[model samples]
Target: MRIFGKFLMGLMLVLAVACSRTPERGGYRPAPGPGANPQLGDSAPHSWDGRGPYGQQVHGIDVSRWQGDIDWDRVRGAGISFAFIKATEGADHYDPSFQRYWRETAAARIPRGAYHYFYFCRSGAEQAAWFIRQVPREIGSLPPVIDLEWTNSQTCPYRPPAQDIKRQASIFMDIVGRYYGQRPIIYTTVDFYRDNRLGDMQAEFWLRSVANHPSVPYPGQRWAFWQYTGTGIVPGIRGDTDLNAFAGTRADWVRWLQARLTR
Candidate 1:
């Protein structure tokens, strides 16, 4: 009897040790570390202080786990007017740097917003709730953003139906809208927008079209912000950083920040 009990104890220890091992990184989870902001096609830095690749007036940068440590003062000094920091995704997963960056951005007095990289498998309401829980109901934080882009992962493949997509979007938008008392900005790519028709809804858009500005394919399409390039070089950052120029002048940015009424 004693031998059997000892054997069971050894077996349990082995299982406990195995349970703590890290899973192999793949799609849906990029390895952590600093990332270089690669330069986009023919997209070189041009005028700043209120202009974009498409000549729009609003400028902002979206951050994720890939982008490593940043110096707040350097970013503010580099003419960055606003930023969207990654907040959360599924119920169990949240960005580690979200609150840190959000507080830093707000402390710098930069108009800052929070975003969630939606998982294809997560329901809209779940995503919304998770994000709400992750981002504190802080008075100074800017409006929240929803990043709806393609999922290039095996963990949660792209299998959601159109109706499901719409339902999910509605659930998330409705919750966030009610939470913030205004519609949250929708951040997406050209392909995702065309495939999902995400623009059918009424929220402001932060479009990503690294190739062409918002004018060519989306003619007459007014956008609140544009992400023209992934690769950017900003001083004070350890490596290449994504740089965004506001669509308008510094004054225009201030006006948007003032009007948000975040409280």
Candidate 2:
């Protein structure tokens, strides 16, 4: 009986050791890629002095799992005209909360779009296929977005030359555009804008300029959406959220969506 008891204890110890060695899934880890501002995109909320200059324009927000579970109804009530939700990143990772958020936003009557974080480490074609696989090509949805930014992590340390980066971006946009039947928007930062000379691309631009208007930083450049502040306070979002404004008025917003949907 003593020998049997000893064998049972040994079996339990081995099981415990095996469990300890298994890797658990990570929760809420933001992707290392373009279109997120590391300084402003942290998990915690940020403080802002006042709503920035684009208050008069049609406003919106962009979000991912990092924002935690969101109340989409409250967000719509906050006078948010639109939203861009993170759908996929790289070649394999899909945002864990994407399906829930997508359904909730649709039910809440807020126009929502899907965006893929472009990874410098992978081919743009592969990343686009990954995004296409995850995000359904739904009618009446806002156009897709390609977010490009420098990765601060060791996972993707190489910043290809300007031409190579542009080439990859073009390939990604082309494939995604073909699948969605609408041109994609390019979300980029000031430094990345200049580094890649993105003005040369045919895709509409979504520029991130927290301190100044995009026009100031991107002189003589036209932009479809300007992300004016990352520390925006909206009713539905628990923490500080990134805020954006369309370049045109409410009528323009309707017209824009109609054109995309019917085109």
Candidate 3:
């Protein structure tokens, strides 16, 4: 019995060593396991006013050609920690401002990412390929975002069935994920989320809620970013811009970025 107990202890030690040696990405630390959702504390008030309920939350903005030329230096100085610059749209319509925004934002020392506006009219593989071609693979950048939501444009108003939508989304994300070494984030609206049941997908979510908190629409789901308002007024930006909040504190945001780097 004593010999058997000693053998069990030795086996456990071997397993412990194996677990401790888990690989990391380029020596970066990994994220905490599930239930490690950002320490965002309690839910805050839901309002359409400019002021956010969470005090001193890490706020950022997403911009494209509509925002005209951006002074990224002034933006960074205004306390913006990050930005999601538009990269591509559909399979062929690359956002004209993508390259300039990407270059200027990085030069300003802002941790930025690129997002592709998905179109139902084009094949997922084609869209993914186009995005990959346009956005350069930069180290230490945020994971590429796949913005999937309904559009009212007359050009392509068709919404594919839920299954087809899911399949195409999966294809696009898989392609981008394999290329970037990190899972892509899905940005969707409330109606789209409900129609497609996107919460089941095994990827991070960037939900859009203009009035209510995300919890009202995306209950019991994990989200990394939230687009709380579309009429946000930022200093360097001329017109209204889409503003987003990282789901955690400043420390949590740093850890989240580190986790993506490790991924």
What lDDT score goes with residue 23 in model 3? 33
Q: lDDT by residue for model 3 over 128-194, one digit each (tens)?
A: 9999999988765788999999998799989899999999989999999999888889999999999
Q: Residues 1-263, candidate 2, lDDT per residue (tens digit)?
A: 35534533453343234223312221111223321221223243333334344343356799999888787766655456679999998899999989888999878767789999888889989999999999988766788999988878578789899899999989999999998899899999999998888888897889998767677889988988988777776666778788887887655765676565412
The local lDDT score (0 to 100) that residue 123 gets in candidate 2 is: 94
After TM-score superposition, the amount by which residue 243's alpha carbon in candidate 1 deviates from its true location, in angstroms, is: 3.1
In the range 1-263, model 1's lDDT, one tens digit per residue, is 35534533443343233223333210011122211111111235443333235333234566866777877666644434467888887556888888788777766655677887777787888888888888876554578888888887777886687667768877898998789765788888887777776657777787776656676656666777777777665544564455454455444655565466355
> Which residue runs does candidate 3 get wrong by more than 4 Å?
1-53
Show the lowest summed lDDT stretch of 10 residues, model 3.
33-42
Report the lDDT of model 1 for residue 199. Answer: 58
TM-score result, candidate 2: 0.79
TM-score of each: 0.75, 0.79, 0.79
Query: How much is 247 displaced in model 3, in angstroms?
Result: 0.6
Clashes in predicted model 1: 10
Question: Which residue pairs of candidate 2 clash?
Answer: 34-148, 34-149
Worst 10 residues of 2 by lDDT: 22-31
